[model samples]
Target: MTQPSSEKINDNTSFQAFVPAVSRWLAWQCEMISEVKIGTVFLRSNTANNNLKMFASWPENVSDSIEGKLYDLAQDVIDGKNNIMPKMTCDAGQGDMVYDTTTLPLHYNNKVVGAVIFLQSVRSEDQKKAVFQLFQWGCALLESTLTDMYEEQHKFHPLVTDLAKLALQDAPVALIGHQICNLLAQQLGCKRVVLGTMQGLQVHTLALSNQLRFDTRASHISEMEAVMEEALDQDQAILYPKSEEMFSSVTQKHQTLSADNEDASLLTIPFSNAENAIGAILLLRPRNNPFTKEEVKAVQYATQLLGSSFSLKLRDEYSFLNLLVQSFKKKTQPVFGTGHL
Candidate 1:
């Protein structure tokens, strides 16, 4: 069967001119390194219902693993909680070979619109970094493309509305904090998300998703505190692609993303209400893709929604109205196991 005309044609008239731009970036990257194949570019679309659909990929040689676990990973990236770098190994007619997969989360406004996935059949360490850098460049190109797409389509309200909602409760401020962390995990497509609380000048680990199950005791809160301080100073979302490498010098047990490792990325979203940053919401992903600006905005909006809900709870009693909001918070939190809240 003939593929859809929209498949991989990156023409000016094509719905996605982003592909050619990405190809140009990849080509430039390949020039920098000899062993790089400009792999296919995959687009994950979010229709009017907020449901995600993976569009056909470029090159056609790169097969999509977006069926089971990979599909879930894509969802996480769309929800804004993914940090895992997906692998690109496939049977190359001749035999099975290793291919490095690099992915970048795509967004329009503050919502995750889709992603661009690249597969490079190179193993050299330097080549891998060059390919990774190309992915980051693709992200930038995709961002510009999205701005054009949004202008042409001019529909963004439904996109933001499709973002998952959280349940809020007047159980306790700590409970709200815990649930917010989980929501960040769910939205960001990370394996685990943790919340750290500030007590005086010291920050304490408050909550984490069950999937991660990291020992707060194992980490020094000072490290997290330092990260948050940096985020606050920057006044923006911070991405920690190689936590282990950056924080390794600081003597903290940091997590790193490897080609073999399933989890791909680590994210820290500073959780400051109208007042101050009570703590931060962390996210995890196993696919090798950095969070997109749209994904970041979705996360920031979700945190703002949670903060608003928390503020409402602080003002009123646990009446039916409050319970309604709290239930939304519960949907995002993992209150079933760790009975801390």
Candidate 2:
């Protein structure tokens, strides 16, 4: 893989080490476009800072004039242009090299976070359209990958801290579950959130966000449990209105639940300990608002952070004699009968 040039504009120490990996990935992606002679990407320093800095450039070396042109095109992309096409000529060793350039903006959570510019050899109108289509596809892939990476690197710490703090609160296990459900619903923009724990082979709903009491036998409650059980049975997260990427996992229950609830989008994540899955969380939002990969990951992380803590709390809820008797029964099972001690 080619390395980016050291000459960076608006260089920030925070992104110094981070930029290279992105640069390499972008370089590789650009190389995939057979017609592209040069490619460059520019990314925002941070959400608060609108400054776009050169992140990566293919070929590792390019004339200053070519770099300047790409930078201008990238700026235009950042300014909200959907697409820009321009013709330019650069002198290669042989002679004047004519190229056609295309630029596209990259978005995360509906916000433009970066831009990519590609320079392809001049071609016919149809061929240029094909190259443009390739650029759009490349931008989509880049956005998805970048979103996951950015969340893992920058958002994980805050998510862990917030969930861990909730787990540490001096509260009952049921109340803690309620808090977690509410927190996740609020954080993930879900209209409702439900938390359920595995009891024997069945998952029991422990808490529902924004609701102090709900009928255990209610139709919606049962539907929610069914969705949770579906995910727990498979031991994997399930997203409703399922994406093509999740085709292997069955989502019938999730679909039914969503359909019954005004076609809302749904996501169920089962969290487990070392032995097996202990509980699952279900999040629901409007049908138009699907869960993003980052939000799904955040919920998965929350379950990992809180699953064992909730299990321990539930154990502590048992009477001292009950726990002691259970422990004794386990210890003496080989020597004595196993029927309720």
Candidate 3:
């Protein structure tokens, strides 16, 4: 399985995203097969009131008894130092049912924050063994999913939050553009990034990474202008699978950077509100790998948020400026300011 990119960690944030990701995965797994009638993940945490809350479910049913049952099972697993459980019986809706089980703890900074209980119905010995193996795999999957979700959230959350805050301010357009470019370069899963804008008849590179260069050479400059304009005119994102080949004739200093310092694949993600193209985000990924669908989707959502915020701020500033002008006009009127005459 493809693991999450290494970025950073936020334990609570990771757990938040992890819980939902695991639940969705369980749902998907059940849909993919037959005979697996039910599945669930149960969690327990001490809330602010010092009461232990049960956040548990079995596919469609979110039962109230899950907290106590899971707390008991969790203690058993921790005390025995075992990773797997089988033939556990628990009350469900006032009746007894044998539940095949596997439990994993949510790790936070190498400490267990909570326990994950994976459950399904038990039938035969062979069936139980197969189910156990599947649950083990699920544990590994959950670990990877949680780690990635946390890292991604950690890396982008600040940027998005900052953008939302900044969008309320009245600032010069050039300044806002520069700040956005800087954040994208530092946060996005890429070595280099560029911010581009379209003028009346020319496309301009608003910002580029400090390490990269752009060819001022006649041939490539025209080509770069053409590529940028196409992206703006079409209002679509562009992904260059082989960025070096795409701009093969251009110099290395101007291309995207990879871990080994090689030229990287490039992605030009367009950002616009309801009006038109505001700008495009240029990102560089590893030479052979490109942005995944999920990453792209995330960036798209961020862009929309940024665009909407920018639009609102601009409208407010313009209104303020108009008010100031009207006030000045009134103050300069003959009756108000020409008192000496």
* Number of the top-ranking candidate, with TM-score as the measure: 2
lDDT score at residue 34, model 2, on the 0-100 scale = 53
By lDDT, the better pick of 2 and 3 is 2
Question: Sort by lDDT, best first: what order?
Answer: 2, 3, 1
- The root-mean-square deviation over C-alpha atoms between each candidate and the true structure, in angstroms, is 20.7, 19.7, 18.7
What TM-score against the true fold does each predicted structure earn? Answer: 0.36, 0.50, 0.38
Task: Name the weakest run of 10 consecutive residues (lDDT summed) in model 1.
Answer: 244-253
Q: Which number leads on lDDT? A: 2
lDDT of 3 by residue, 1-341 (tens): 24433344333233344456656656644543234444555443421121233343456674546545666666655444765556566665547777666665654444454555655666565444444444443444455455556456322245544543343334655566666656666666666666665556556665555533455444534444455665566566665653332322322222422323454666666665556566666676577667766556556656665554444444455677999987877777766665532
Write out the backbone clash pairs for model 3: none
Q: What is the C-alpha lDDT of each candidate?
A: 0.49, 0.73, 0.53
Superior by TM-score: candidate 1 or candidate 3: 3
**Cα lDDT for residue 140, model 3?**
48
